[model samples]
Target: MIKQTQKINFGKRSGLEVYPVSMGAMRFPEMDKAIPLIRQAIDAGMVYIDTSRGYGDSEIKLGKALKDGYREKVILSTKCSPWVFKAEDTDDSSADCTYKRILESMRRLDVEYLDFYQVWNINSPENYEKATCKGGMVDGIRRAVDEGLVGHIGFTTHDEPENISRYIDEADWCEVILLTYNIFNQKYKDVVAKAHEKGIGTIIMNPACGGMLAENSPVIADAVKSAVGISDAVEAGHRYLKSDPNVDTIICGITKPEDIESTIANFKKPAFDAAQISAIEKAMNKLSPDNAKVCTSCKYCMPCPAGIDIPAMMDVVFHDKVLKVPGIAKEKYDWLTGENNKNASKKPSECTACKECEAKCTQNIPIAAEMAYLARREEQSWK
Candidate 1:
């Protein structure tokens, strides 16, 4: 049985102590599978549970799992997207409208009050303005807090680091902030530190870069092994985030019992010291010139006119060449282009070099050229 280690105060302002690793219900399995996993996590000391209205039926599944006295043991959180509501209809951000949505979430989760309520996906300056404007979603959540229907209020974001920092500075009422940060992308390092310095809780989402870091990579494995003497990339990724003192907690999207077990086990292991972490960082930084050119799989450049999955193809190229893991890349390529896969789009060879996707790329990647190269590689090596 996994034992709960000493808990830490989540933030100076939140007044809630929690375990370092939390459970995210975004990928919760079916009810029978979810109930055991939820109980196991809480029983093993992962007491902070986060869900969102955007995650289909997650709130309902979590609600059912929280029954039988499981509700009292967690710091429950859920988010609402004001932008999604606005897209559906105006006045969705009004205090009454937002409150009704909050109540509906509570009803689904079978909770009297939520521990934390976040305005979801405040990804740009315009989103920030809309959320904080008079009678906005933030105002509506504040009204809920005033009536004791919710506790602390915060926001989740996928915005740039500068914008996130600006939001942190301006949103004094925000007690917590959730954002994506991982070993592959430390762009938010300063933002995490700034939030911590200001007594705002920092929750890290996608610590593994949406399973990219979790995949086998000889380069990553060697770096981690040299630094910490452990070679599991996923464990190394989680450890890197855990070592950041400014990060209050990491939310792992658990889908099965074994996932919870592995997460708890990783948490129980010791974190890398400063020297070790520096060594790992230095090793990763020493990659070839192509390292800077690697795709992050953010999928900003998508929807090819020819229907090619530019990100997946780019990922295959990265793993095969940059990471020196051709086997994994081959497996992914076969799966993506296999005849049996009905959802398979155009193969890399089908790319027409229209350069449409290149225009939308955030990283300024040469999408057409990369696709052509991948197509050549598929012909020469992948069969």
Candidate 2:
């Protein structure tokens, strides 16, 4: 049994006590199998359940899981797009769009009301302005609140660091803010602290950067093992995120029962001290220089024209080069090339050197070159 590691009073006026770790239902394999894992997390004291319209059948799975009194035990958070752009605009159209989306989410989740409904992907000030305009999405949210369909208003974003500050500053009625934050990019730290100061609860997404920190990360593993005497790298990665007081909760996309068990085991450890944090940081800074060029698996550079799973390929490269695990890398590369892969058999060998993916990269990585290099390396290794 996992003791409640930490619970925060969410939203200065909401009077809701929330666990500092949220169960993210974004990466489940099958609903029937996923339900037990969800229940296991709840049993482990992680009761804040986060899902979204975009997370492929995740809401339906959650709806099924929450049956027989589980719904009432957790704080449910879901998101939907707020914009309804039509060639011809009507006065009440935007509100109607937002309301319809909320209703759709509720129906999908088989719930009467949402504890928290977020305006998804608030990426810029312009997006914010459009969402809060007169007769816009905020009006729709207000209507839902009055009708008891949604209890509170919140938003999720992937905007630049400066824009995150802008969102927090302008978030007058927001009860919560979900944003990308992890040990890799601590730029959001100050903005998150500012949000906490304003009584807006903060939930961090991508704490492991879509499993990057948790997978074959030797630098982080060594650092964590040295600093805290914890041999599990994933546990140390999570502990680093939980150490921040400004972080009210962190949403980890757990797929298996073992994932929850690991999380519970790590949360049992107290937050890292100043010296420990410093030591870990020092250890991490000593990683191979090329390791920084490796894909963070954020998928910010996505929707490739050639349909290549760029981040996945880059993960293979990192594993082969830095992690010294060529067999695992080759196996993962094979998985990416297999028929069952959702993105199709999009091997790096298929890259056309078009440089389109590079343009969208936040890290400005030479994606085409890397793709070519991976292809050559894999071909030679196979032969």
lDDT agreement with native, every candidate: 0.83, 0.78
Pairs of colliding residues, candidate 1: none
lDDT of 2: 0.78
Question: On a 0 to 1 TM-score scale, where does candidate 1 land against the true structure?
Answer: 0.82
All candidates' TM-scores?
A: 0.82, 0.78
lDDT of 1 by residue, 257-310 (tens): 677778778877788899878876666665533455677777777777898888
Tens digit of per-residue lDDT, candidate 2, span 1-383: 56465677875745688887778988986877888878878877778888887788899999988998999989998877634222224323267878887888899999999998888788878888877888777788889999999999998888887987877777787899898876656668788899888989889998765566656656556666877788776676678877888888888688887777777677667788888777666665545334466667778888788888888787777766776556667778888888856555577878988888898887788989888888888779843
RMSD (Å) per prediction = 5.1, 5.9
* Model 1 Cα RMSD, 1 decimal: 5.1
Candidate 2: worst-modelled 10 consecutive residues by lDDT: 84-93
| Cα misplacement distance, residue 236 of candidate 2 (Å) | 1.2
